[model samples]
Target: MIHKLKKRRGIPAGPLRVIGSRAQRPGPAVETLEIVLKCDSFGTVEAVTTLLGKIGGREVEIKVIHSGVGDVTKNDILMALTGSRLVAGFNVGLAPRLEQWTKEHGVEVRLYNIVYTLAEDLGALARSLIQTEPEERILGRAKVIATFKSSRGSIIAGCEVLDGVLAHGRNFRVVKAMGPVFTSRIESLQVEKRPVREVRAGQQAGLKVTGFVDVRVGDYIECFDPPVGRRSSAWSPRGAVLRFDENA
Candidate 1:
């Protein structure tokens, strides 16, 4: 659970006031956040609620203010203002002049485009309040062979896996002659025109990266496993070793 500040319109911003009073002490644990939710489509609302349920479990609470047709009404804003809670909207928008009203009332309003991002934001807040430690592990390394443009206009790198394995969805860092230059996740991977989950050592594959686009030949790409938080542990390989015959 996360704690959100409650603000009164006339009061000056100072120390946090718990449950609408300046004298009350904060709770030992942030019980739960009551969020006013609005979404443009019923499907999106359902998806967001499902994801939030999965992520927050029983630690969060949501009140759907508007779903499927309407924009956030003044009543919704008034509800949040009087209740001293947050308002989250997906694809739906706030009515004109509501932004200023929220500011005046000191209510927080968050807007999101993607459902995953919306859930991620709230989940991150909760995790932060709980304090989670994440560990990182390297997975593989590949040498860039060539660069090309995909039909969708994304830059693709033709690479040969030199060590371990390069898998789809793995985080990667691009290293040039000087030093490491860029870092991001692999968007797509293909082996000989066929999509593949992974490319093992000594195999060549095409890689589409998400953020860092300026990839060139001879650059090194290092793949790493997703960082795991202390609360959730998942199996990950340590390393793969290859030895060449000395006589050869």
Candidate 2:
């Protein structure tokens, strides 16, 4: 049996209700660049479309929202506005008058007579769109064995490196039996009363922490750092929000 649909585009637009634009496909590690392609003929359209498909690598994706065999028209530019704001013409050109209109609309239109040049331009465009995301890696871990006040009145947790190396100026998370307490960057790390940059596994060191002082014995400390050249001075709590379970 067939049933009537409930909503289209948004909650059926009958009640003067206002809704935001529809969400496009989600972005991923490989960014997507949408384009409206117009060529002189269907054969050229198919050939260029196939070439564009294999142009981008895993970093960026080139998607053709619409392809047709004709000169660039207002409709094609409109489609580009809703997509990547780009239009490519192969062996075709936009009407002379539409040039000004396209610029005012903030849409880009590229006309190419040579297929090789077109492919080269598109390939470079894809590379330009590649976005490099910050990468994170755990530097080391340790367990708090004691706590004491430093000469500067800052609280220092005496920790024993349990598995990995712990480095100063790296972000850290203090976790207890209950859950994670807080996170901050390690301001100071030392061994035998001397300041040190890092401590390897099986080594005992004093770690000075700012913005938090409640570290307790038996608490685990996780130290992490972003890739080199990436900003590491700021810290964000990766642990889930703390909630007490009455049943537990």
Candidate 3:
């Protein structure tokens, strides 16, 4: 998720009283003070919430205007700040359509090119975006996935690699009606555990995920790769990588 601070000019400053005295001291004229939390996935909401809480503890008044997945539309931006006495600025993904919309609306919206899977960079970006106060805290977004396999109760899963890479020996989630039912690791990966490095989109593979029982067919397995120490290397078996969707 991306957090941003927006300020505007030309609004009346509210009443303020000087400390330990009856005289009135002028508060900084705040024609506009709006904060926006933007993200491309629902999972980012938690991280954004935590960041806001930390900022608030330091006396920054921030309200979440909108939080959801998908591209940020002009309507979403307008709705988020509508009826407020102050104008708002925006920080969103670098999408051309969004940029055009911002230009038409005449609101200054900053675009950030966030590299996926890097937690430290994301945290730093969030901090830089907020100018009111500074805090030394590190926060990151978590990765999640769902696994599907046979009904034999073994770790052999015929799964689709969505969003991010699913590698051998990595921890994953077995989604059930009661939320995440179990946490397991990929014991082995194969076109069937024949020793593969990574799996990508559009290719079905058998994964021997460990630590879960009753892993029925069609059950989803979710996995998370923390945003630390993630390598930028390409997945091997170059030909296999090509088979996956470039957009995935």
Candidate 4:
């Protein structure tokens, strides 16, 4: 029986209506990132291909498959690099030397032990290529000096504004000698027992925190604003996508 060959690249074209007795080899999509699959078992390859095809839709093209670890060779990596494709493996681990070589040669490879995680990762990668996401930026820092127990069963941190201005009702993180311990918002702020909206650098203020209680006297406090949305545009980092090839 002759099966129709479908084009998965550029503008959609009608499937090639051909007539042949034997099955023809499937081709990777030219317009999308191609993926090569390596699995320990043939069944795993079939299952993963179906799952990825459903989740990735038309954004990803996974066509090459190696049924066993021994079937993987340098040729696979060369094909991947030449075609600008990614190689993914399931339970077919690569040797330490080969893994290092791939990294040094700038080959894109990832291993996954779970099926759903692979699909989710592929979907996320596809979305990231075209979607805008939010990223965080630090705004200010403070140092906790003294902790006072309030009558209302809450702990307040007497802090010295370190870097930027510390404002009331803003998000804050408590950093200990080891690392960050808690994150909360400032319930209130006061300077010398007088209520204030914000405290500038090198100033001392008292902070009432909500959603945390273990703030220590020597801990460092850091404040951060809400994450700002960043979209990938021609003028941004997303526009100049870098592709490295060590073999070049």
Clashing residue pairs for model 4: none
The top-ranked prediction according to lDDT is 2
Query: Candidate 4's residue-wise lDDT over 1-248, tens digit each?
Result: 12223233322232111112222335643223355666677677768766765554443433443223433344455546543446666665654456555655566666666666667665565444554466765667888999988646567899998899887778888899999888888778999899998898999998886567888888988888877666653111111112222232
Candidate 2 worst ten-residue window by lDDT: 235-244
| Native-referenced Cα lDDT, model 2 | 0.72
- Candidate 2 stretches greater than 4 Å from native: 1-33, 43-83, 90-135, 149-154, 210-213, 226-248
TM-score of each: 0.37, 0.51, 0.33, 0.42
Q: Which stretches of candidate 4 lie over 4 Å from their true place?
A: 1-133, 228-230, 234-248
Whole-model lDDT per candidate: 0.63, 0.72, 0.43, 0.62
Model 1 is weakest, by summed lDDT over 10 consecutive residues, at: 235-244
lDDT of 2 by residue, 1-248 (tens): 11224333322212111113323445556666777788888777778877888877666767777777667777666667767777788766666577766766777777777788778877777776765556878888899999997655467899999988888788888988988788888788889999999999999999987767777889999998756664332211121111122232
Q: 1 or 4: which has the higher TM-score?
A: 4
For candidate 3, give the lDDT of residue 197. 68
Clashing residue pairs in candidate 1 are none
TM-score of 1: 0.37
